[model samples]
Target: MSAGMAGREAPLSRWTLLAFAFPAAPISAMGLPLVVHLPPFYAGSLGLGLTVVGAIFMLARFWDVITDPVLGVVSDRFETRWGRRRHWIVLSVPIMMLSVYMIFMPQGPVTAGYLVFWLFVLYVGWTLLTISHISWGAELTPDYHDRSRVQGARELLLIIGMVCVLALPAVIELANPENLAAARVASMGWFVLILLPISVAVAVWKVPERKAPRPEHVPFGQAVKVLIENRPLRFVLLADLISGVSGGIVASLFLFLAEDVLRLGKFSSALLLCYFISGVMFIPLVLWISRRFGKHRTAAGSALFNAITVPLILLIPAGHPELALGAFLLFGVNMAAGPFLFRSIMADVADHDSVQTKQTRTGLFFAMLTSTNKVGAAVAIGLSYMMLDVVGFVPGGENSAAALDGLRAVYVWPATIISAAVALILWRFPLDEAQQKANREILDRRMLDAAAAAVETRTLHPGDAQSSGAPAD
Candidate 1:
């Protein structure tokens, strides 16, 4: 055990957790803008070719996926006085800020090359900040319920950020759908710029990093072997992909669903706001449910709940705002559960791995999951759009009735099946509250043993006793 884990307690305070999670606000604010707002803004507003812009975004995502693991490996191995995770967070700030600025505030004529270069740079920065931030949070506590509390607060702040960005564009566009072209996207950019630094500053200044002993550097081949044997991680990553793809399908089809199926095209913003608000309001309830049922079981239960409710949108009669609103409200019940639970569960998985292998590879585990999540998102968006295009469903529903049905089919069925699979796949997930506690005990024992060995070694050779703290692996 490294000196950092000697006499360490695994519980955290509310203030500490809050400070630890605050950066998620700005980071979450960047998500909707990058995925939803930026593409249309560039193609439609700036007159860039739609095909070219789409290709550039795809290329950027590919680049982002590749970098996630590399950054994770780097964060886990790099040690410094400042900390492992926070230094990456600090380094990522300027790169992200510049990327955000370039994407949202383009000056001269934009080309495919320009979009490709800057978008790739931006996602690399996003991956670095996000993977490190999440890996840091996972290391903060070993208590099963404390993990939920920390992540629940992050989800809350994330919702606040999402609503802020989503509402601004909708509010501005609602008043006059044609007005404030750049300002809509620009507002989110400015929000990220202003919020990113302040949140990072607070998190760094207030939250203390837990410097666990670094594991002996494993070669890449050995790292792969270790990962292949991490059963809990594999199970959770499977759940993550299934649930993430389902949600992504919904997001990809949301605007089309509201416009053509529900006839709420004019009030899409209001509909989105209703969904987010409902999800945010219900998080406390989910937290309580998690405490009672435990993380994996609760996650599976929520997936089942979503499976039951999400597809009901297909049955609602067209041109009925009341029915659509009611369905969205119901669907919102499980919206926050997927993200909140997956994060908490992954933490447990990391703990399990550390206990079994004597290595804390939180960063690499998180990065691999992050990369797979992007794959799910990409598949959902691409497949849904391709399916729509195949069925002759135009963007504005300016098409035949058959085309609308095609859009509706693509929207509902994939999500229904995927959510169902999430429940089935995760039903037997290995790590639970009791199992995690046992794992923590093993880790503590190993830590104490290592520390004793170090002390004995120093006593035997007094000249070798370096009055210094070492990281615990």
Candidate 2:
């Protein structure tokens, strides 16, 4: 091992940290726009049928599911002069930039096939960039609080992106186009074209990677077995799935609840702004909680509190935006905690796994986290839509009293139950400060041993060494 590799890591400089976190803003900026804005842009602006648009989106997301793990595994095994993660990030940016332009700024005679093809292309780029970024962040720090800071900065940037994207439509309204969707989508295309490349380039240039030794070959079955056997990873992923599905259901039903239950349909924008603003405001508090109480307790406690508060929405009368915002303030606090710690916790799981197996699977661990999140969200949204239909809730027509009641039930119950389940399940999460430090200590020793062995083998058989400098698969 080089002296630098064996030496203790310097604390991450603020510029490097912010640059590391920079790309998240644009990437996360896409989230709100994709779900909230893009559908209307396609259906109303482009005159696509709703059924066709829905099918196209579903197909794109499912395709994303397949690509995520593949990309993760590919990234885990990849090596380059630019380093494992930054090279993948660089590769993904151009693909996504072009695809964004294609999807958002469609040319003449758009069809369902056009949407599906370009959207799938967009997801491919998204998977590559996101998985690489997450795993890279996990690799950046080993200290518990530092990991929290890294993910917190990343999550904070993501929310900033979401807030920024949410504000764009209002800006677009001032442009006053005959086709709002066209202008909005075009603006998003330009945003990605400009921001994605610059942020990614800055990170690639400025950040220093701790290049862990990559073994020449890890069998497919062995990778699966390690993943399955990592109890902490399994627990965290399960907690993520349950909470992710709950949150997805709430998001899917939020507009319906705003209209039919809370009667704040007109104030939906204000209400959403409140949720995000409160989230941004509460990040420091969540981080403080994580540092003081540990990530597991902070996340689980936040979810438990959130679970307690979600059902209280049922008690708020119709048309009370003030009360709704107040409720969401609590929601935002708890919401902030989950992502902050969940990602932090996953970093620990990655570290723990690397220690156990003597291999780095940071990318694959985060792949499980990101892919499960997408899948769970998809299932939740589909089931929520199905249940709403079964409960006789009409889209535009006057809904019955019973239908409104069902909407409230759908929004509140699934989330509450699942969040509580997440809290309960996290009670068994194994990593604590001592355990994590012990894992890192062992990993450091392993690095020293590998480095010494490499030197000895080179001296003994300089011409015959094989795995030394072998290309990452």
Candidate 3:
């Protein structure tokens, strides 16, 4: 076995895991602004209109259909002395910083053209950073439960970053209520800008990238065929799509639901804060549950729980922010469950594919997962905003009973149904820990055989080995 692949069964130190997960804080910090804050900021505050904003966001994600996979392939096949995933992550930093500035801190009158242009640019950077980071994580270790720990640390930091960002808006709201939307959105932007570089620096500096076995060159057509044939990949993607759409619909509409429907107004940020903080508290519990019940079953349970409880949001009194907070608390219990478990599951799925094809396609697998997730988000944003417009719900304006009812229905029903579907898809996932461990054993044995063959060749050709930098003893 290659020295880099030698310790396939050992656990990573907690410090290393934290270093690896550090950048997730900033990346996830960026997510809240993009999903929850940006659409409304552009549409309502900057006068883009709901349909225009929705289309812009959707088209940007559609753009991901191209970038995600291409980058995935490039990162998987290409490498630098710095490492395969690290260089792309470093390159993504400046691109994201520039785009974040343009999108969040618009200098002039922003047009639909401006939004579309910068958004496309941002997703390129986002895809590069995200795909590289998660693919790197997948190759970090081969152990089943350890994978959960790695992703759990990431999800923990993700919620913490979200909580910190959301807290800013709430603080701003308390101190100054005028032009609150603009201030709060810009606050999120600055938070990401300042922290992204610092967090990424610590991660790349501290976390050693694992050297995956070099993939044999497969034709593009055959590669696509191999990916399409991956059944676990299919299950993870579909479940992720359903869950993404469910989560995206709620995230995109949360401000509307809180301010217009629930009359929480600026306190919406506090409610979001509560939601994410709840996620922070529960991630360890979720991880513990995953280890005991198995990752897929634990994920299924979380989805099922969400499905049962999401509709109960309707029971909260419209004017009571306290009731809304309590409901979000309930909903947030499972917030950290699906994302981490699914990514960990995808790591195992990538290993299964490697066993089949003798190629490490972690980046490509994660790229497809990311693409489905973004597509789901795109569909959710486009569909929800259109529904809102169709029902005559106006942002930052008083609404009739029918419009409010439309907003409420659009918010809860789709997510509830889709959550149930996610549960069903994951309930009987086939690739358990035992299967993954066996796949690893197969790959390891092949590596051992390959290593022995190389040694034999070198012993028979000492002159050739000497010329190629091997000592001829």
Highest TM-score model number: 3
Alpha-carbon runs more than 4 Å astray in model 1: 1-10, 47-55, 174-181, 217-220, 466-473
Model 2: pairs clashing at backbone N, Cα or C within 3 Å: 1-451
Residues 190-229 of candidate 1: C-alpha lDDT, one tens digit per residue: 9999999999999999998875876855576776787798
Q: What TM-score would each prediction reach against the true structure? A: 0.92, 0.89, 0.96
lDDT of 1 at 332: 78
TM-score head-to-head 1 vs 3, winner: 3
Per residue, candidate 3 scores C-alpha lDDT tens digits across 1-473 of 35335536679998999899998988988888899989999999999999999999989988998999899989988888988898889999999999998888887889999999999999999999999999988888877888888888888888888888888876777778678788888888898899999988998999888756677776878777877888888889999987879989999999899988899866787898989988888898998899898999999999999999999878877889888988999888988999999999999999898887778788888999999999999999999999999999999798999999999999999999999998999997889988888887887777777778888988899999999998864
Q: Please give the distance, in angstroms, between residue 468's alpha carbon in candidate 1 and its true position after superposition.
A: 7.4
lDDT per residue, candidate 2, 101-175, as tens digits? 887788779888888888888899999999999889988877778888888888888888777766665688777
CA-RMSD of model 1: 3.2
* Model 3 poorest ten-residue lDDT run: 1-10
Cα distance off (Å), candidate 2, residue 357: 1.8
